[model samples]
Target chain A: MAPPTTPTLAPPDAPPPSTDLADAEPDTGRKRGLTGYLLLLPAAVWLALFFVVPFYSLAATSLYDPSGSDFRGYEMTYAFGNYVDAVQEYWTPLLRALAYGAAATLICLVLGYVLAYAIAFRAGRWKNLMLVLVIAPFFTSFLLRTLSWKLILADDGYVVDTLQFLHLLGDDGRLLATPVAVVAGLAYNFLPFMVLPLYASIDKIDPRLIEASSDLYAHPAVGFLKVTWPLSLPGVVSGTLLTFIPAAGDYINAQLLGSPNQRVIGSVIQSQFTDAGDYPSAAALSMVLMVLIVALVLVYVRRAGTEELL
Target chain B: MSAARPAARGTRPPAGRWLREHLVLVLGLLVLLYTFVPIAVVVLMSFNEGTRNVYAFQSFTLDNWANVCEDQSMCDALWVSIRIGVLATLGATLLGTLAAFALVRHDFRGRSASNLLIFLPMAAPEIVLGSSLLALFVAAGFSGQLGFWTILIAHVMFCLSFVVVTVRSRLAGMDDSLEQAAMDLYATPAQTFWRVTLPLVFPGILGAALLSFSLSFDDFIVTNLNAGTELTFPMYVWGASQRGVPMQVNVIGTVMFVLSIAVVLVGELGSRRRSRALSR
Candidate 1:
């Protein structure tokens, strides 16, 4: 779909180039008509039908009488007690999921920042190749990769053997079936999400600024803090959100790598729906999880001063 | 580059200087290697001989690769995933490309609202998205038909947001001057679009399509919730994990990894060559 353009009309004056496009106004001569709506109609309908409407359904489901089973068919009693029961029963897993997500996000930031910095400022001619390498691991299936982690952290694996040899672990200690493995899996799997955004942000920082800081006798560490770190905040915010949201919702790593003690909110939701057929509680838990994430994201975006993220 | 630095005077120890200079690069390479550790395991295990214990690598054998479809069910699941991935990619890309164009090229009321609508799906977690869709299906009485169509719908729903974001960024970054130039040359709006605008945005569309396919194929959480008895490759792998995982799973993993890397590398090389030609 193209806007009607007159051959004689001059193009609109270009705005000063800025990376942030969210707030930018449409350029002059943009079609101020029905075409936009028409173009957007199909997608809007799909999302409205599938994405937006589902939430309404979920909300209704959440309020269904908890005693109603899926096989017998749930009735919308508007009980609202499902939320109370869900929170009371599954609060531990929900909190544990958030904690694991936060821990993984923190690890990703440290590792992602270093790697992104190197790619942005130091890779030189090898920049593109390194970026490719960063994304290559994701080409593999997620479950397969997490399964590999299971093997890597297996009780009799080399990693545990080394840890035992170094006295880092007792003889009976293991990485698998532990919170550590689950968190590491989350961190590892989501590192690319962290790295790509951080790289995009860090790559745009003018090198001259860093050089000028050094020239002014700022130490390397001090310069990095003052110049590079603040400039990459947008990336950090986006990357951490990208990493944390999926990690928190993820059950695969927890299911495959951890014991029952390490079960997360996602695993509970799945089993509730599929195994227990408790639609109301499952729906309630999902709603709670979404609401919690949305609230956290709002507070986070406001605190980070990246209102454009919304 | 280092020689031009003021601090590169021959006062420091060469060994210490070298280590300090390359430290970040070394560290970055190590982290990159860490990401590949699983792929290495996957590739190695693809050649492993069968054993009751599937965690550790057994003696070297190429039988797994030779009999990649030893488990017929795994292959069936894989085919289902591929078909759904293709169809979902097409659906999401078509719809999302249109939305992206609308958001970028057209001035309209409630534009910010529409933008938020597109953004919400990406931000929402997969479990929530999956469950909500499942709720909708159950509510709509389509729960009995939950299979390929339900899985496809969920995939498209989730992937649509990403496609819109990806394509919108590309469209935003484009130099609109070329389209303006085409218009100045008396090209009709349709002509300008086909000859100038679409060509310029084609790379982004292609990228988004590839991304959509991969996302759809690799999806587990959302698909599993909606996939009533319909197993995809990831679900197969998940189920197998509870029992003993087949070595052939590694074979599929290795193939996907190699194939995608090859696609990416080829794209990179093609772009490099094009740039070289343009410069020349």
Candidate 2:
């Protein structure tokens, strides 16, 4: 909403002026290095207190259930079954999240990668202007942007009207609140994520390499398939992973754009802590999400060569 | 899209070659439109004077913008979010700078561990991370609802890694020699840092700070988890969605969006000027 969500990109600021600090300042015994450590202390303390402590507490909370009516602290029982019961309690939400995430990733890959490629390679002079457009939506509040989908997909909105005209739907328009709408929302919001990284990767790719492929008696399509795709695979991995991970956990679209019944684990977790007042179950649910995401990340890294991007 | 494609990519080749070269280009434009249309629809719809959605514009009015200002709750929530964003940015930037310095310059024990920990919040899904923080806050003996402190703390946690990343990348090129030279001149370490090293990294720090503020202001997930009774802009807009969103939400969103862009522009412009000076 506020920060343009392009992670891994360079900050617009030019490089710093103190480039020669290392070369100029040899580590003299007279000069103290602990000064840097002192500079680091405040942030370290903040992270330790706010970040590290809470995570450990969360991990601990996942193991316990309500002891009595007080519900103030953990019940003495360290039950691992909480995870199983939690998973069973919320399987539908979890599956729906995964499905929505998958659909969104697919759409983003289709649109975002293509856009990135075009802007990076084909739309050379227009790259910055086009990128500004691609990133423009993000400049607005995410909620506002998502709410736009509500307007567009409203039963009486232009989207339905346009689609109906194209005969993509029946006379009645019913795009809003559908799984498709949720997925489309996710893809639209996160597409710049896919596109930006891919643009960086593709832009780094030399056109001469593609020409070389064609020069070697290769079909144009073959050149693209063999040279371009493989070289750009790192971007694909980065972009897809970036899109898929967030889309999977997103409860916002499902809540606002889609039906409540289609709740993801995020919404489920939100209810557990806020509405349901079930900390143990919420903790259990969170652990499952963390595990699944980590496992998937690991598998993707192992199988799909994601480490290359890293 | 068709408007741009034929004009731009049509270096007329054989039909097969033309299609081959432009396939990604054509498909890419269509995809970008598909991605862009939803937000575009909203921005356009905000301009509609009519209440209901329809093909025809009944009239154009400033009623929504007027309504947004009139509503006290939205104003309160927007202010609360802004306060939190500013506070979150300040808190995160201070820590993030230190952390970034440590990660980049030091050969400390557990550096990798520190690095991974620094990035953990960013790496995970926002919900999970938010929930984890909420649980932590709850465990600290706060229950029912967390106040501003909870929201601010959560925002800081979320934005810290970003601050670190932005600052760290800039710090990568810092030559230790300049600091050594300053120390050799009998300047105290703090003086050398403030006058020499600090000025050099100030842009990165400011950029990181502005970036962090914008991100914190826009945050929904972590804030939702920890924000007990306190409502932020995103929280308000989200709640509004259940009932058809008022045009005020659009008004506020457009305003906030423009403001954040302005902030980024300032940061960028400042840096560009610095770069131009250095290059000269």
Candidate 3:
């Protein structure tokens, strides 16, 4: 989820002194030199030790000799062949995860935009209440909520029956253990990630700009296209990245709501590590997924012109 | 209210006009309702009587709620989750608050680099984070001891970034003149900090703590990777799902939902009241 950066509600009387202090001379400003470093040292060290060092460990683990088992211990063979083997064996699930993630993210974007827009522009005095409602349902256990989806979309459930009755599904069509269920589950779980960022941006839009466009004879849709969409690009970029990253790596939906056919890269990696004890292959797969997501995010962020989001 | 004025004046508005005007709100609400469908299921299933087909409702009964601990393992897992959640929240909140203050209140070298560092963990997928940590643990020869401490470390690592972002935003948006005024009035630096600054920043800290607790408690992916034999609530649920989930699981789920919503509502109401008081 996007970090909820509450828009600054600067008191009416308080002059915005933050920037003024920044512009002031160091001598005239608050003491800054050693205290800042002192404060930062703990977290910086924590991140360095746990976060940064682990990446190096993962990289090293990815190169270990695949012939070795955990009990016998592995050799540091620097086996680049592990990557090749992983790709050769698991590429289907890898690509499937990415495709599912993309489909789910697109779905979330449309649904999220409408909900966010309504909350921002239409909810009036009910804005905060509606925002709370958006997150309230999500406060329940994620696994439990997802399990509910399994029951809701079961073979005998109303959703499938309704679809069949509406002539949208075949008489024997089932929802559980299907790609549609996996994607829908992904979209449902990650919708808040899309909505919150979008709401943050859309809520900041100056309503007068839309009115001004209308005053100049622009159609409502045209006004939205020219003003609202461009202004909300930052949120769109962040939301899509947030949604896509987790969705691609997620296996819970695929495992619970889907079948063997819907297994994703995450499930593959998990099974390889725990079940197969093939640490090298699992590490290689994880590294590949991370690299691919990072590459896609970079290109997407660049194209969207929201580098500041980083 | 504006749309209701003409109707109040004894003129019946066109049904189509009203629908068109409020279309976005209706659509938005429908989406919200859709999100809650699963929660509704969870709540409804909490009261369901025991049946062979756990997925379908059999009959309404309160036995599950009454005997939430019938499955002793589930309660044990819940306890582990709570302990880890509280410890992780404390560690993350302390380190993160300090870092947030450093980033927002003072100028420093490598500030941009630090910001990027904070952002990267959030951007990285949980699978990757979990795998990387597991790899590290294996490499360090602690693979045999993958349990509570390891889970706590992973939770704090992930939750740290979110805490920093939350507190940093609040600190950055804050006005510092109050502190300056306190100094002008001859109060000590610590006095001003404890009295004025801490009180204002406390809400953001509390919010971050709550966020961290929820994230830690509900985590499964990372915990499953590091927790060799220890079970968390989510892990227990995942395990149960493979066989047949006990109705008591739904009881716990309902309790979590109700409790969290209560907390959020209370916080929201308190903040609103505070703002109203401030305005006066």
Candidate 4:
């Protein structure tokens, strides 16, 4: 409320240096170190116990014998084959999740870039109001929003009808229970993630740079490419990762808006744990997803020419 | 921050320039409209008179709004969510604010590692976090007792990272000279912190708390995994979606939407008034 809910405007990758860290003096400053450790103790301990320890448990579970049931008690036989088996069985959904996530991230970038650019450079006195509007849609429950999308894309709904009228869709073709709806839902849900970071980066660019480019012989398009796009790469990198990681792991949109045929890896992981009670298989799949994302993000951050990402 | 400056160049044709200048704004508004289409549906359908089984809006009526709690389970789930959201926010904000202060105001070894640790929870997908927490609980023999306490732990764990980031930014952006001046004016360390630091950081804490509440309240995937048989609002909606959805769900959604918007509007107006008074 104090700053109008733009708390996330700060780039996640580039954390500000601590007061002492930025100081010219190079010593650790023993008193400050003591205070720092004291203050950091509770959070550090909590994260270590719950956040860090759980990964160990998950990894251990992943290597447990796949034949063991929850009732029968799992044996940690170090069955690394669970990873191979999980991938073998669920490769299609895994690939589909990555594909869907990539498409949604790209769509979010396009739509979000337009909105963020408008708010950044063109909104005059309406800037604050527009920024608030950007976050307003997110405060509501995401499940509720996805459900509303369900209704909006219903078989007999206006969207489908309008599409048929325009001959973009066949008379019998539908938006509901389709990959389009799932991807659309993903893009809509994660659009804010994309916009906020882009706005944060784009807003910081001095307008004079763009003006200077135009003042030269450069066309407006060339000026934008030379000035705006390169300056906002940090935001683009972080925004895409923020949108893509969750989009890849989300099952809610697929579950609510798509048929069983469109199940993503998230849906598979969820069902494996909840319905099939296959903890080992679920754990294996979860680890795979986490590893794949981490590896991809590392490569992406490197190629994006930014080392700021944690 | 102001954009009232005239265009940099006046040589272009007026008509083409006007279109080019405003094109992104128009396209941006359309994108916003796309985001709001579903929220509009939620608001509209709150007045719908559809019965238990039908998904369509048949006629307009206020029955759903009037009897929002008619479905006892929905009310119960809503209460559960509210309670969890409050507790999680308080826990996360307190611990995270302390962590943020440590990171920003002081220097220590393992600082980079600590920063990465704080960032990891936010980066990981909800499904992975939820599954790993559930695994820990099961392995620790708390499998059968996975209910209120487990949900609270998971919520705090996830929310803590966000709180840290928000408060850390606010703290880092603040000027330390104000605190130094207070201390030089014969103020005790506690007095300086309470009078100078706390006021400056309070807004970040408030924002973090609000963000945490919305996140915990709207959360479905993590809460679902650790909730056991205990139901939250999102879980209620998930369960109802598979069967017949009560219109009361829409009523609650509308209420939440209205309440959050009202809060934002009031804050905006208050800030505007304050700035006006200061300028005068």
Q: Model 1 clash pairs? A: none
User: Which docking class does model 4 fall in?
Assistant: medium
Tell me how candidate 1 scores on lDDT. Answer: 0.88
Candidate 2: fraction of native contacts reproduced: 0.47
Order of all candidates by TM-score, from best down to worst?
1, 4, 3, 2
Residue by residue across B1-280, what tens digits does model 3's lDDT show? 3422133211224675466448888899999999999999999999999832486888999998888899899999999999999999999999999988877765566766787788789889999999999999999999999999999999999999999988987877777777667767887767877998889999999989999999999999989999999999999999988888989999899999999999999999999999999999
Model 2 per-residue lDDT at A51 = 74
For residues B1-280, write the lDDT of model 1, one tens digit per residue.
3422335635456677677668988898899999999999999998889843476777899888888788899999999999999999999999999999887777777777788888889889999999999999999988889999999999999999989988988887776777878888888888988999898788789889988999999999999999998999999988988888989998899999999999888888877887798679
Off by over 4 Å in 2: A1-33, A66-73, A308-310, B1-36, B50-57, B173-200, B265-280
lDDT per residue for candidate 1 within A200-264, as digits (tens), equals 99999998898788678787789999999999999999999999999999999999988877789
Candidate 1 C-alpha error for residue A235, in Å:
0.8
Fnat of candidate 4, please?
0.62
C-alpha lDDT score of every prediction, in listed order: 0.88, 0.74, 0.87, 0.87
What's the C-alpha lDDT at position A293 in model 2? 87
lDDT tens string, model 3, A184-246?
999999999999999998999998898688668787789999999999888898889989999
Can you write out model 4's per-residue Cα lDDT over B1-280, one digit (the tens) per residue? 2463465566677777678878888999899888889899889888999856455778999999888899899999999999999999999999999999888766667777788889899999999999999899989988899999999999999999999999999987776667667766777777878898998788788889988999999999888888989999999999999997888888889888888888888878876887698679
- Write model 2 residue lDDT over B155-226, tens digit each, in one string: 887789889988988777555566666767787756877888889888889878977877887889888888
Model 1 misplaced stretches (Cα beyond 4 Å): A1-3, A7-29, B1-17
Candidate 4 or 1, higher TM-score = 1
Clashing pairs in 3: none
